[model samples]
Target: MFNFGIFLLLLGAVLVYATVPIIKIFNITTTKGILVVKLSGLALAVIGAIIMFFAQFPQRLEFLRLI
Candidate 1:
């Protein structure tokens, strides 16, 4: 779980980091394009945070122990 969380966090961070240049490259100055990029980035970040949070729960420890 911890590993998964770390992976997700890193993936999300990378997605957000990479998106900046992509938006710039496409000249995404329009309101719609800007909104799309921002929303996607925000969604990724949220998913990453959720993964990390779940990884820290006691229930996850018990599940791991069962394995």
Candidate 2:
């Protein structure tokens, strides 16, 4: 799970870093389309971070009863 999270984080970073090229590759021009890609990357990074955080602190997960 932890490793998966790291992978997701890296993937998200790549998506974000290559947004422009991605846009060009997909020919995305609309503002909404651009925003969706950006937000998707951000969401992945956040979810990955949250996973890593919980993995590192199991007690916190239990405390929050999130799992």
Best by lDDT: 2
User: Please, what are the lDDT tens digits per residue for candidate 1 over residues 9-66?
Assistant: 7766666678768788888878788677767777777777777676654554566543
Model 2 spans with C-alpha error above 4 angstroms: 56-67
C-alpha lDDT values of all predictions: 0.70, 0.82
lDDT of 1: 0.70
RMSD of 2: 5.9
Candidate 2 per-residue lDDT over residues 1-67, each given as its tens digit = 7667887898888888899999999999999998888889999999998887666544445565554
Residue 28, candidate 2: Cα error in Å is: 0.3
Give the count of colliding residue pairs in each prediction. 0, 0
Task: Tell me each candidate's TM-score.
Answer: 0.53, 0.78
